[model samples]
Target: MTIIRSLSEVSDNYRALFVDLWGCVHDGVRPIPGAVEALRAYRKTGGRVILVTNSPRPRAGVAKQIAGFGVTEDAYDDIATSGDSARVAMFRGAVGNKVWHLGPDHDAGFFEVPAILTDPAVIERVPLEQAEGIVCTGPFDPLADPSVMRPQFLAAKTRGLKLLCANPDIVVDRGETREWCAGALAQLYTEMGGESLYFGKPHPPIYDLARRRLGAIEDIGDSSILAIGDGPLTDAAGAMGEDLDLLFISGGLGAEETGTAIGGDPDPEKLDRYLAETGVVPTYTIGTLR
Candidate 1:
């Protein structure tokens, strides 16, 4: 893999780009340096940029949060969020209406389809058997250990409740810390013999949504699309699975494993081994989006 400094070096090759949000554009707390500018620059040059995020929030909600981090709407042509995909599944009767929400209040918007029981007190009052299924947005607290929810998970599992994971990200960079996400919980539940459905990167639904959004802006084929992100397991794997080229950011989630600090040159040997283990070979590698 070749490491470059910015997307501008190879932006001309793709008509539509699927850009990851959390680790690629920002670290959850602030915008990554030049990340927003790089996307805006790509758009200015006639590229259709789709902010494909594993965030559990709906597209509007994620857009609002990213704007708080200085990411302007003009930075991308559109957004496709896991929550939006999950909402589509819910609308299609994939999951029942009486759902047990297993995340924070900020993510309760995912349950806006009807009466959402967000109150912890009220939720505790209702028996686990009463809920038809579970909708997990994320952990109760991003900073806390995921094991704290094991009891609830077991209870739901015992009741044979299916889980719909909105965000399939196991972990994400939160400023200087690594925080657990809903995918971790969903994986744990599945390990304990619970059936779970995931809607995000590394899954087909979210990518399908992103491709449709990009198609609306430009009639580009998969070969003319590039997926850019920091996580190899999510972004790289997703792009490779969808048969699209990938632009892997070396300094984000795989920094420690690849021995590439943020804004630093990636250790080629380590990066190669890491990609080999994940079975994802990116078409391009950059220290950062810019």
Candidate 2:
């Protein structure tokens, strides 16, 4: 694989790109430096770039949130979130089946299939045996205590209902706050002997969705399309599975321990150690695009 620096370094080969939203372009609150410029430049070159995110919100909802961060819809060709993919998957498989909504209310919009929002009061009376599957977006602030959530998973485990995780992200740092994602809940549920299906990134469905959305007008081959993000498990893994080039940003997912962008005294060594341990080698590793 080719290791490089700067977004400009990747200007030549790629004709299309699938950029991640949360970490690569923005941090859920604001846009990252050079991200907008890089995307604009890529578009200027007649390249197709699509923004894909694991946010547990529908495409329209996510578009509104992105607009809130000053990211206009014109920045990329299209946007696809895990929530949209999950709902599509759910609707494709079973229609009108009841689902146990297990995430934030904002994500509840994904499940239009007779979903029962996991309200605190309702949990007392409602049995997991009643639902067809559990649609999980992320941790519930009211039920994030684990003690309460575990019981729900336990109930689902006994019934053999699916736990479809809308967002497969394990954790995400919203500005200064780091919180768990649906993947974390799914991990716990899986440990409790429940089946979980991830909807975004690393999964083929979302990748195919992103590719279709990007348009790929230039007919770019595998090496000419890049997947850029900060997370190894999601972005890099997605690129690997899709046979696309990857640009892994270190500064977004984890805080800069060495106080550097790409690598410095401690950061470079730490990155090396992480790559060694995970065995997920990326085409490029940088601190930030700027």
Candidate 3:
């Protein structure tokens, strides 16, 4: 893979860029250094930047969260989130009406529509057998161990309830700590023979929504649309699945296994082996967004 030191090295080739938010642009608490500037620079060159994220919150909520991290409005053209996609699916009756929410209060807005039944407290009190499906926006408490939700997941699995994972991210960096996400729970449910539907990265629905949004802003082709992100499972896999080129940020998630120290070059042997094992190779690898 080509190793890029900066985004400017290859920004000119793509017309529309789908940039991952949390790991690439920020660390959930603060903005990553030079990330916002790199996006601003790309936009100045007439490239359309879409902040594509696996955040379980709606696009507006994600935008608000990022803004607090110092990512200005001009950095990107628009935002698309998995929560928005899940809302669409729920509204269209694709995920059913009676739903049990498995996330915290911050993501409650994802089920605010009239068509879906998602009273957090009520759902928790009611038996899993009564709910049609489960909507997991994120872990009930990101700081808690994933095993904390194992009993509930097991209960839901026994009932044969479908799980709709709004965010397909397994984990995210909260400051310097790693926190589990909804994807981890959904994965556990799938392993236990329960059915699950993911709304975010490595899935087609979110990418389809992003493509339509980009198409409306510019006449772009698959080859000219670049996906920039930090996760091999989510970003790289999603880009390859969608037939889009990728600029993988090596210093983010999976950095330890790749032997890539934050803000440093990746170990070629380790990176190659990891890519081979995952079967998700990026067009290029960069140490950071800049």
Candidate 4:
């Protein structure tokens, strides 16, 4: 794959971009250096930017959160979130009317009814014993190991409760610390024979929503759009699945594996080996967004 220093080298080719949020634009706590400029510069060239994220928040919530990180409105056109996608399913009774929440209180927005569903099912958060299914936004404690939920998952499995996973990210590096996400819990539940439904990256529903959002702006085809992100499994897999070209940022989640140094490019040999091991071959590679 080609390794370049800035997104400008190839930004002219695509009419739009499907950009990942966490690792590509920011490190969770703050904005990454030059990421904002890169996005704004692309927008100046008339490229529509869709912040397609695996964040388990509605588009409005994501916008508010990113704005606090210095990502202004000028950087992108629209957003499509995994939370928005999964919420539609929830309102449609993908799990059931009564669901047991597995995440913390911050993610209670997952239970909100979407505006698109006029006749939405009335959802209620009940105890595990009274729950008809499960709505998992993330772990109750992200730092804790996912194995702690094995007993609960076994119980849910026994009762045949389906788990609707909002975020499919296994982990994200918040500044310098890594934290587990909902995907870990969903994976554990599935391993214990409990059905788990995913709505985030590497899944089709979020992409479908992203495309529809982009289509609302202009008629941009898959080949004319570039997908930029840091997740090898989620971003790369999602791009490959949709037959879209990818600009893989090795400095995010796979920084150590790809031997990418801070504010520098990845080690070519190590990046190659890592890509080969992961079985993800992107159209391009870069260390940082700019």
Q: How many clashes does each candidate structure show, in the order listed? A: 1, 1, 0, 0
Question: Which digits, one per residue and each the tens of the lDDT, describe model 4 over residues 1-290?
Answer: 89999999999999999999999999999988889999999999999999999999999999999999999999999999999999999999999999999999998777778888899999999999999999999999999999999888888999999999999999999999999999989998888888999999999999999999999999999989999999988999999999999999999999999999887899999999999999888999999899
What would the per-residue lDDT of candidate 1 be over residues 190-281, giving only the tens digit for each residue?
99889999879989999998988888888889989989988777888888889888999888988888888766768889988888887768
lDDT of 4 at 26: 95
Best lDDT goes to which candidate? Answer: 4
| Candidate numbers, best lDDT first, in rank order | 4, 1, 3, 2
Off by over 4 Å in 3: 114-129
lDDT of 2 by residue, 1-290 (tens): 44455677776677877888887788779887777877887788887877889987877788889889978766787787887777776665531256677777666567553232332112211335678777787777722544558877887789888888888988787777777888888888899988888879788878877766665444556667888887778888888888887877777775454244533222677777666765667887777754
Lowest lDDT 10-mer window, candidate 2?
116-125
Reference-based TM-score of each model: 0.92, 0.87, 0.92, 0.99
Better of 2 and 3 by TM-score: 3
Query: Which 10-residue window of candidate 3 scores lowest in summed lDDT?
Result: 116-125
- In lDDT terms, how accurate is model 1? 0.84
